[model samples]
Target: MEQNTAAVIRLESVHKTYHLGEVQVHALRGVTLQIRSGEFVAIMGASGSGKSTLMNILGCLDRPTKGHYWLDDADISHMSKNELARIRNRKLGFVFQQFNLLSRTSALENVELPTIYAGIPPAERHKRAREALERVGLGDRAEHHPSQLSGGQQQRVAIARALVNHPQIVLADEPTGNLDSRTSVEIMDILQRLNEEEGLTVVIVTHEPDIARYAMRAIEFRDGKIRRDQEIEERQIAREVLPTLPSLEDADAEEAEEESKVAPGESPAKAPA
Candidate 1:
């Protein structure tokens, strides 16, 4: 897919402050940044570095205390809650660290949720949800609930849900945090494919340097401001790295071997050294 150079998100002198009792907490300083359409960006920071705040602002979940925010060429700096809700449903998709799927609902049902809010008709919503699940390689698991799936599978379902709306931008916050190393790569591979093949703008917030390397650009936040903003040199391709990592079967076999080493009455951790 051809990359678009138009700016999808623009923030100028953005600042966010929270008042707790008499204390004012400045979550974001005068931050100015622009993310182009069809770009993959990673925001990195520590606990109080303000990356999360910026994400909230970008997602239109909260209003900026001061400054201008333009998303998809519209100034949404001070949109009403109802207006923001409409914008979120129409233009943005979000994935979180936790899979956030309803435990009792089927994967297909979960994916259909966003479309419902978008006022899609029932038949079309079902069709789109099925397509989304297929895109995430979970077409056969449409009837399965979250409890029936593995952590990685659950996250895949979440990704499918995010895509059901055909959102222009996907905002993922620590998307791989709950998965194992190999599973993390698998998730990243999906994200990479979405950006490269589908031309969807991807922005993620992560603290891991390894994870940041998968993005084309990395923005580091410190003390409520952008500390570094630069292109990644020699960026990693997740699909290429997957082949070098051990498979799930290999991991299970290694675990079984370790268990066999333990005496009948002893646990694996208490086995003789």
Candidate 2:
């Protein structure tokens, strides 16, 4: 993807502090960064490193305690809760580790949620949702509930939901965390295609080095500050990597072997014993 020089997200000396009882917890300390339009960025850090806090601020889910944030040309540092909600629905899409789909809802209905919040017309919302599902390669599975889909398919539906709103930026927090290695790459492949083919700006928070390599740029956070920011010289192309990974059939066979090790009535979670 050709990187656009225009900055879509800019944070100047951003700081976030939490007051828990009488103690203060500093989540972000004067962190400043810019993510240009059409760029794929990975934010990496260990637990308590504040990467999640930064993502929340960028997604307009939370306001910074100090410093300024400019999304495109508007400064949203002081936007009210309702205003922030409006901006989130209009400009941003989010994917999380949990997939976060409604258990009883079909994938198409799940993807239509953001549009409903945006007050899109019902007819248009259905059309957009179907198109988004097709974009994520889940058009055939649109009527399936989350329970009927595999872990990878579920995440793809979540990705479809994110795209249904036609958001300028997609913010994903540990999007592949719950999946196996091959499935993780599959999710990254979808994100890569979205960025390269659709020209969508992508930002993901991940701790896995292999997953981080899929991003064009990597930003490492530590102790509430950015410790490193650099382009990935040997960026992994997900489409290329996918062919080398274990095939879905192979993964399924392995999974079946593991399931056989557990007694028929026993939960997989208790198989180790």
- Which candidate has the highest TM-score of all? 2
> What overall lDDT goes with each candidate model?
0.88, 0.88
Candidate 2 regions exceeding 4 Å error are 1-5, 248-273
**In model 1, which range of ten residues has the least summed lDDT?**
264-273
TM-score of each: 0.90, 0.91
Candidate 2 residue lDDT tens string, 11-46 = 999999999999999999999998998999999999
Clashing pairs in 2: none
Candidate 1 global Cα RMSD? 5.9
- Model 2: lDDT of residue 202: 99
Model 1 Cα lDDT, one tens digit per residue, 1-273 = 122248899899999999999999999999999999989999999989999999999999988999999998788987889999999998999998877888679999999999999999999999999999999899999998776666667788999999999999999999988766777788999999999999999999999999999999999999999999999998999999999985653556455334423421121121122
Would you list the clashing residue pairs of candidate 1?
Answer: none
lDDT of 1: 0.88
Q: What lDDT score goes with residue 188 in model 2?
A: 97
Root-mean-square deviation (CA) per prediction: 5.9, 4.2
TM-score of 2: 0.91
